[model samples]
Target: MTLSRRQLLQAASGLALTIGIMGLPALAQAAETVDIDELMKPSPLGDKVLGSEDAPVTIVEYASMTCGHCAHFDEVTFPELKSRYIETGKVRYIFREYPLNQPAYAMSMLARCMPADKYFDGVEIMFEQLRSGALSGTFLPALTKLSKQIGFTQESFEECLTNQKLLDALEAEKTRATNEFGVKATPTFFINGEKHSGALSIEEMGKIIDEKM
Candidate 1:
């Protein structure tokens, strides 16, 4: 069964309680406006970039692996975005982790544990697993199976999830995004330093990319 948004959030919240990660809170107040320059600053977390660094339009996406909207974008919009803009060198697309739960965090860690060149590949595999219903049952087992497919032995997979340094870096990245950039949801996009939230269609994205160009 497809998890509703509420269910997903609840699941994430429960996971957060167990793992000591901060659960997403409601937007109780207007988000403080952040400096565009600061928002555009390159993060030390090492970007998963898909186009030339010098591309005219830069799209930074803050996404959670367990976010259905993010999965939808990965399955739908990203291919077109990649072909028409990223592959053609009109845009530089960067993906940053903003995991919403322990499972998402663990998946993100697995992705980061791979060689930098393989990071996006790892992300794609995880997204595919989510799409295929493989991520819904016995989370660790599902993740372990996926990890093995990506050349991770059980020992390495366990080590990757427990890597404190990597976890700290990811937490720092998420904190920066939340406090400095006002990111509150998955699939948040900053196109040419303009912040937009939620899953955007290919046409909508095209319009934004065109405007930036």
Candidate 2:
């Protein structure tokens, strides 16, 4: 089946969250820094955070599930970044959804629907499917496959997608990111409140992270 009116509306309102396609510099301008308190304030869905509270560096990533560069970062850089930084307790990571399209918004909803402990794993699988072209097919079916992989029943999947409260919360999160944090695209990184747009490689990210350290 196709996207419902709710799903269609989800994409249409995104970005106003679309990160412009590449070709610009990797790091955003210096004046774009944000206040950590304001950036970390409460949110509708709350943030999906990983790693230690005491980690010296905090990396906040705003991403769209459908963005190719975001996918590339997920596939290539995130694993290393997570291991060396997040898992090692050097960096605390925060992942926020900034869906750019209908599929992405729906997929973001699906990721949040998974058990809280599995949120990051669920997101990893969604990007993995996107890379494998599994999610490139019909909407619900592909999304259903992902849902099943993470233990969702067909009924549960439909129910989750149709939930207005969750949808509203997700929409509010995106809107807040745009207004408060200046997240204009997928794979935007804020390393210690320094905003940088686009997917970043390990070496590139590590360098900035090193400076923060």
Candidate 3:
């Protein structure tokens, strides 16, 4: 379902508690395996790649900002992956938006609004805020705090969330992921064209990356 700006803000107002208590494993279990070919289809919305183009392995992630499991991976697992793979240029990591709810859609749009170099920074901040229970209260106040830290003023914050074009683009991308790539849940990973779901441990992710190399 497409979420308008007001609806998304309303969703964000109550999202913190829902995401805080959500079961990550249950979210993982909701996803079904898809063919590697289908999982590896070119992203319709382009990509936000981190690492060298020539990296031997490519990792694509479809994640929702409001998903508890996605937050766990971002907070716990991603640093190691970034250091060992993304930083060393062993893997090219691409993160795609797959908002599961209206709040998630709003957060994704905000991330896109940041300068290209700050996009991932915006995402990490959102995840951190989610983990810290910052979005539990009024959505605008929490978001405004983050926006100020990232150079976004009140005007820009409102404008970004209300950008209909960006919202539609994110919706289209999410639709392609669900309909074409069989992505049923957040934190779904496609490593070297193989689909996996869940908050995979560093060792588990490393093994797969090593095998690809």
CA error at residue 115 for candidate 1, angstroms = 1.5
What TM-score, to 2 decimals, does candidate 2 have? 0.87
* Tens digits of per-residue lDDT for model 1, 76-118: 8999999999999999998999978768877888899998888
If scored against the real structure, what TM-score would every candidate get? 0.83, 0.87, 0.87
Q: Model 2, range 1-213, lDDT digits (tens) per residue?
A: 234547554543342322324213355455368999888775688889999999999988888888878888988899999999999999999998987777777888888888899898899888788777776545666666778888999888878888777877877888989888887777788889888887788998999999989
| Cα misplacement distance, residue 211 of candidate 2 (Å) | 0.6
Instruction: Give the worst 10-residue stretch by lDDT in candidate 3.
Output: 22-31
Query: What is every candidate's alpha-carbon RMSD to the true fold?
Result: 7.2, 4.6, 2.9
lDDT of 2: 0.79
Please, what are the lDDT tens digits per residue for candidate 3 over residues 117-191? 888988999998889887766665677787788788889988998887788888888888878777778778888
Candidate 1 TM-score, C-alpha based: 0.83
lDDT of each: 0.76, 0.79, 0.80
TM-score for candidate 3: 0.87
- Model 3, which residues run further than 4 Å from truth? 9-17, 21-23, 26-45
